[model samples]
Target: MNPLTVLRDSLYFFQRNLSQIVTLCLPLVIVEAILQRIVDDAVGPDASAGFGLIVGLLVYPLYTAALILFLDARSRGESPRNRELLAQAVNLWPRFALLSAISTLLIVLGLSMFFIPGIFLTVVLAFSEYRLVLRGEAPLAAMKSSFNLSRGHFWRIFVCILAVLGPLMLLKEFSYSLFSKDDNTLLSLVLDSANSFLQLFVSVVLFRLFMLISDKSDQ
Candidate 1:
């Protein structure tokens, strides 16, 4: 599974399913961005970043779990309704949110140690969400399985993630420079929502990798 092939396939899937994805996930993404803006305004510039992470924890798992379910449905040649996906996602939210929190904490801790360990943890723990959401593994168990599953495949997964996020990071900076949030609240909101929505592509790529690796490992 070359990174390029994985990216190409993922992009194709993302493009083909763009409308469905937008319909299924964009509203919650926008809500998250709006809540973030509210928190920023409420706390002012000196607020701890953890407040923003709290906003994310409130909404991120809902749409993320829904998207993962949508991806799985499409893979199996099924077309599930948005409400159905959202309902199922709601049910998964408690565990998924806890899983997200733990994963974020571990990544952040690893990042505090010279940065490289965090990157390594990021690659290795990539599939934990899928294991939890799709395979019904508990949070810690899923993380353990993902660590074991990612062995010898670190570079492949890391490269794909970098390729997808690198350009996004640059574009986000550029957009912020061009349209200062203080000057244009509406535009800033649009930019924030768009950026978060596009980041879903990374999810698509990782889901693709997860499926491929799991299938191979099963053989």
Candidate 2:
């Protein structure tokens, strides 16, 4: 699994299906950002950061599951409507939410332990969402499976993630420097939504890698 090939293909897919993806996920992403902003405003600057995570948990699973299902459908050459995909995602919400929460907690915990472990955890747990959503595994089981699945392919996955996210992180910093959220709430919201939406491309690349690894593992 060459990281460049994975990135190139994922970029192509992202560009090709940009319209459908925006229709399917952008509203939810904007909603999440708006809710987060509301929470921030209510709690003031001293607000607990975890409040944002709580808001995310409420809506993240919905759109993320829908996006994943859409990715699967497109890969299989089936054209699924957004509403239908959303309904299926809603049905899968409970499991997906649980999985996401667990993953986030573990990643956060790892980050607290000097940061390197966090990066390691992120890489190894990359495919847990795919395992859970695509194969119906329980949250913990999916995480464990991802750990095993990512064994030899860790560098490829890690490099691919960094390649995609590195520039985005810089863009985020640059945006913040130009417009303080407190002073320009609307612009902040727009930037936040756009950044979050672009991050979905990481999911696309990871899905590609997941299929490749799964195929090899099965064979």
Candidate 3:
């Protein structure tokens, strides 16, 4: 699919299952909020807090993959129990966690050299969780698969992600500009909350895209 069409379909899918999506993501949202607060308190306005926050943000993708796996199974007319889904997800956690750590390290290392490589790594690994969840691949294999899947489609996927993510980011910036206090902490919190919600939404959309891409590839 073209970028715009992918975005349109993703948004439509999200809206169609909004209630179920929200219900699945609520726990992750709460956990993200708490982690944000903790990271903020621990780092206290330092630049390193951004890195810590990014590390914490990895949790959402893992949870999102689990949710998408469960939802997709149901969508395909499979009778998947929530507990069974959660167990399967948890079983994969160690591998996922290791891959996430490696990915984060690579991104950070690349960014330390310059920023471009970091962005490249981010795009390449974008489909790792989806690959792992959907195809039952090992973490490194999934990462490699995601990289290959995204190779020729880099710009397309990048544009699609930005289309969904850019507006939410702009809104957060505007809110902070309008309502930021002298202290900045409250504004930071508000922006973080907005970002968390947007990330959750994007995760769901991306999962749908992964499914679509996989189907097309199969055909």
Tens-digit lDDT string for candidate 1 (1-219): 999999999999999999999999999999999999999999998999899879999999999999999999999999999999999999999999999999998899999999998999999999999999999999999999999999989999999999999999999999899888999889989999999999999999999999999999999
Cα lDDT tens digits for candidate 3, 18-77: 666556665666667667676667767665745574756456555666676766775687
The TM-score obtained by model 3 is 0.82
Which ranges in model 1 have alpha carbons more than 4 Å from their true place? Answer: none
Question: What is the alpha-carbon lDDT of model 2 when measured against the actual structure?
Answer: 0.93
Which of the numbered candidates is closest to the native, going by highest lDDT? 1
User: Each model's C-alpha lDDT?
Assistant: 0.96, 0.93, 0.71
User: Can you tell me which runs of candidate 2 are displaced by over 4 Å?
Assistant: none
| Higher-TM-score candidate of 2 and 3 | 2
Q: Choose 1 or 3, whichever is better by lDDT.
A: 1
Which 10 consecutive residues of model 3 have the lowest summed lDDT?
180-189
Error of 1 at 99 (Å): 0.7
| TM-score (all chains, Cα) for each model | 0.99, 0.98, 0.82
What is the Cα-based TM-score of model 1?
A: 0.99
